[model samples]
Target chain A: MMTLIVLGTLLYSQYRKTTSDKLKGSGNVPYYLIALLAIGMAVGDDSGMTMILPSRGLLIWFDPILEKLIE
Target chain B: MQTLRISSNQIAMLTGCFLSAGMIVSTSKEMVYQAGQDAWTGYFFPMVYGALIIVISIWLYKGREGITLFELNKKLLGGIGGSLLNLVLFWYLLSMLITDLRKLAEFVKTTLLLNTPVSVTMFMILLLTVYLTRGGIEVIARVGHLYFFLLAATIVSLPILLINEFSLANVRPVMANGLEALAKSSFMAVGSYGEVIAMISVMFAFSYQKNPKGLHPMLRGVVFGTFLLTVLSVTLIGTVGTSISARAMYPNLMLVQSIHITDFLDRLDIILVSFWVPSYIIKICLNYYVLTECISSIPSEKQNPKAYTIVLVPLVFMMGHLSFESVVELVHFETHVWSFVTVFLQVVLFSVLIVARLMRDRQRKKEVELT
Candidate 1:
C-alpha cells in the first residue's frame, strides 16, 4: 500500500510536469529506476525472500577487523 | 539551493536542538558503561574536540562566505575530486540518517507503540521528514526555533523533578577510574559531539544574514548543546547510578520514568516523550535536508529537491529496516565503528580544504609579486 502511494505520487508528479529541468530532460528515468529497485527489494524482503541485504552487513564488513584494532 | 535566509540565532537553535536530541537519549548509557561513575566528566575531551571542529568550520566559512562545503569542495578539489568527496559525504549523511531512523523506530517500538512494526515507525518518521525537507531550510529552522525552548525547559526540569531520586553518592569518588578510563570514555563521547560538523553543510544559508561576529552563533549553539548533554549525563548517573543506567537500554528514559512529583502528576515520561519526539524529528529532518542538499549540489544540472525527497523515501525505509539486527548491535556499531569513521572523515576533509586554501593564497601572492 505504501509502495503504491509512493509510485502513484511519482507518476502523478511526472505526468503533471512538476519535475525540475534536470529530471524532465532525463525523462525522469533515474527516479523511476530507483523507485523500481527500492520497491522490488522491499517487496522481496516482505515475502521472506532474503533478497534485501542488511545495511549493516553491507556497510560494516570491516567491523570485526576494526574492533580488533581498537581493542 | 533556495535563496531563503534564516538568522544566525535560528541556526544556533537548530544546531543546539539537533546536537542535544542526538546525544541525550542515545549516548548516556554508553557513557556510563565506559566511564563508570565519571561518565559526566568524559565530556571534557569532547568539549575540546567540538570546539576545534567549530573553529575550523568557521575558518573555512570565513574564506568563502556564501558557498557551501559541497561547492567549496568543487572549487578547491576540481571536478572529479570534488564529486568523489561529495560521494563520501553523501554516504556519511545517509548512514547517519539510516541509523537515526532505526534508533527512533526501536525506541518507539519498545516504549510507545508496542505492537507496531519497525518499518511502520520508520516510514511514518520519514514521511514527516520528507514533508519538512520539501518545505526547505527556513521552515525547518522555524520549527527548530519554536521547539528549542520547549526542549530546553523539559531538559532543565529533569534534574529538579528527579532530585529525590538523585544520589550524589552515585557520582562520588570522582575520577576514581583514572585518566585512562576517562580518556577512553571521552573517545566514545566524541563521536556524538563531532556531529557539530553538520553545521558546515548549511553555513551557506547564513550568507544573507549580516553578523559582524561571524559564526559565533554556531559556536554558542555547540556550547549550549554540550552543556545540556553534560547536565543529562550527570542527571542520569546521579538518578539511576552507573550500574542501573549502564544496564538499561535508554538511560535518560529510565531517569524520566522515575519522576514522581505526586500521584496526579506522576508518569511524566509520556509527556516528556511527547516533547522529545519533535526534537528527534528535527534532527532527522536536518540530516535528511543536508543529504538532499549534497545530492542536488553534485550534478552540474539543477535537480528537483521534491523529486529527490520522494525517490529516497523508500530507499531510506528499506535501509533503516535492514540496518541492525537488534539494539545491541546498533549501539555496538555506533560506539566502536561509526565514531572512528566520522572523526577520520572530518579531519581529512578539513585538513585538505585548509591546505588547498593556503596554497591558493600563496599562488595568488606570487602572481601579485610577478606583476
Candidate 2:
C-alpha cells in the first residue's frame, strides 16, 4: 500500500511537471511493481545463512604460500 | 535517452565503466585459471583470433562513420529484414544485462549486504537502473562521467589491499604455458573489448555531429578501459598466481578481502562496494537506454519513450531474474553462451553494417566524380 501510495505521488508529480504527458497510473506500474517484488523476494529469503569459513588447516596452508606471495 | 548521446570524453569514461561486465574480466580470469599458470598464454593466443573478432566488429562500425549496426540494418535490409537481425542483437544485449544484474546482486550479498536478502539487493539495483533509464541517456552518461573519481579510488586502493599478497616470483616463468596459453588469454581479452560495442547505440542518442572530435576521446577512453582490465588480470595472476587466482571466485574482491590492512580496516572491500554498485548502475542504465532506443524505433514508441521505459523496466527486471537460476548457471551462461553472443553479435553485425556503409560511401564519391 505504501509503495502504491508513493508511486501515485510520484506519478502525480511527474504529470504536473510535464503537464502534457500527464500522470498515467500505467506510467510506472511495471517499473515499481518489479522493484517491489524483487525487494520482497530478496529480503524474505535466507538472511541468516553464511558461507562456510575455510578450514583452519586450509587457511594455514594458504598462509605460507600467500605469506611469501602476498608479502 | 538524450543522455546516451554524450561527449567523447564521457564515452571514454563509459568505456572504463562498462568493463565491470563480468563476461570480459571475470570469465577471462576463470578461463585463464582453468586453463592455470598457463592461462595467460591461452588467453594471449586467442587475442590474435580475438583481434580478428574486434577488427571485424570495429571495421563494421568504421564502415559507416556515424550510424550504428541497429540503423544500418534497417537501411540495408528494409523493414522486416533489418528488424529480424537486430532482434538477435537485442536478445544478446538483454541477456548480458540480466546476468550482469545477477553479478551486482551477488557482489552486494557477499560484501555489503551479507545479511540482506539477495532479492532486495537485486531490487535496489533494478530501481536505480530503471530510474536512470527513464531519466534519459544523457543523464546516464552524465552520471557515468561523474563516477570516475569513485571508480578510480577503488582501482587505486586495490594495490593497498593486496600489497601484502603480491609477489614478483608469483609471475615468474612467464612463458611456462608456451604460445597456446598466451594466445587463449588474449582472445578472452578480445571478448572484454567486444562488450563495448553497445556504446554505438549510446552514440546515436547523443549528438556527435558538430563534434567529430568525439572519436579521439572515445578511443582514448577505450584504451584506458583496456588498460584497467589488463592491469587487473596481470595483478591478480601475479599476486595469487595463475593457479589460485583462476580457481578463486571474485579474485579481484578476494584480493581485497584477504588483506587485514592494518586491522582497523579489516575489510576495506566494503568501501569498494560503493564503487562496484554504481559501476553497475552506469552499465545497466546504458543497457536499458539502448534497449529503449531500439524499441522506440518502432513507430509508436517514438512518440512517447516513457511508455516503453515503464514497460521495459519490469521486463528487464524479470529478464534479469529469469536468466539465472543459481550462481553456477549464471556464471556458466556468462562464460560460454554470453561471450560468443557478445563477440559475434556486435562484431559480426557491425561488420555487415560497415561493409554496407562503405559501399554506399564509394557510390556517392564515384557519383560526385562522374558529375
Candidate 3:
C-alpha cells in the first residue's frame, strides 16, 4: 500500500509536469462508476455488513415488488 | 494526438478472447445446474439472442461513427441523465471485472497454488493486467491476436481429445424437465454472452480503421466464441454426466484432468490451465484497458495513465479479494444478479438509446422537411 502511494505520487507529479495540458476533459462518469462499484464490491464480505451489493439486498427489495406486480 | 489502430481481424480476436475466458469453467456448470441435461439446448437460445443484440449494438455504434458510449449517452440524454446511465454501465463492468478476478483467483488457489494466499494470486493477475494496459490498446490487441489462434486451438481440440469419454446416454432425454425449465436456464446464459456488450467501450478504438472487412470478423468472433462456449458446455455434460458437471465447480478442467497421453504423461490439466491463462489475462487486460480509457477520458485524470494504473490496479486487486466472503456468495450473486445487470445494461439500456436516437433523428428529418 505504501509503495502504491509513493508510486502514485511520483507518477502524478510526472503527469502534471508533462502531459497534463493534453488531458481529455470528458468521461468522468465512467471512471466514477468504476471507482464506486469497485469500492462497493471490495468492501463486501461475510461480516454481515450490508455489502455484497444488489444480490441479497436487491433480491429482498425487488422480489416482493416483482411478485406483487406479477400477482 | 495520433491514435493507434488495429484491423478488424484483431478486433474479432480481442472480442473472442474476452468472451471465452470466463465461460470455460463457470458457465457450463451454471447452465447444467439450472437446465439439467437440456443445458445445451438452453445455451442455444441465448447465443442467438446475444448475437442479435451484438448486431444491433454494432449498428448503433457504427451509426454514430467513432463516438464513445459515454459521449453518445451525453448526447442522447443530456448531461445528468447520461451520467446516470454511464454509472449503471460502469457498475456492470466493474462488477464483472471483480467477478472474473475472484473466479480466477479462486481457481488458482484451489488448483495451482493451494498454500498461497488468494490475494497474492489476484494481485499478481492485476499487476500483469496493469502492465499490459500501460502498453495501450494496440499492444493488447496484437497480443490477443497472436494468442487467438492458440486459444482457438485449445477450445477446438479439448472436446476432440475428450471424445472417447463422451456418452450419448449422458445428454440423452433432453427436455425431460420441460421447456419452461430450459427457457429459465436460457435466461442465465444471457448474462454470460450478453457481456459481448463490453465490446462497445473499444468500438471507437476501431472506428478510424474503417476496415473494409466490415462487421464480418466482429460478428464471426461473437458467433464463434458463443459456439465454442456452447460446445464446451454440451461436451462437459456429455462426458461428465449432467449431475456431476452441474455440481462440479470447474468441470471443464476436470475434463482436462481426465486426459491421459500415456501412463507417464498424465496430469495434463495443469498444462491445459497454462494455455488458458493467456486468454484469461487478455480478458482482464481488456477490462483494465477499458477502465483506463474511462479514467483517461476525464481531463484531470488523463495526463498520467501510469498513475491511474498504479492506483486502480491495486483497487481492482483489493476489490476482487474483498468482494465476497467466499466463492459461494460470489457465485450466488453471479447466478442471480449478474444476468439481470448484463441484460439491463446491454439489452434494455441500449435498446432504449437506439429508440430514442431514432426518434430524435426522425424529429430532425421532419423539421428539415418543413424548412
Best by TM-score: 1
lDDT of 2 by residue, B300-325 (tens): 11234455555444445544554455
- Most accurate candidate by lDDT: 1
Q: What DockQ class does candidate 2 belong to?
A: incorrect
Q: Which of the predicted structures, 1 or 2, would earn the higher DockQ when compared with the native?
A: 1
Local lDDT at B15 for model 2: 61
Question: What digit string (tens of lDDT, one per residue) describes model 1 on residues B14-81?
Answer: 87898888876677787788789999888878878887887776666664777667878887787767
Q: Which model is ahead, 1 or 3, in terms of TM-score?
A: 1
- Candidate 1 residue runs with Cα over 4 Å from true position: A1-40, A43-59, A66-71, B207-211, B302-304
Rank by lDDT (best first): 1, 3, 2
Worst ten in a row by lDDT for model 2 chain B: B296-305
RMSD of 3: 4.2
Whole-model lDDT for model 1 versus the true structure?
Answer: 0.77
Model 2, position B17: C-alpha lDDT score: 78
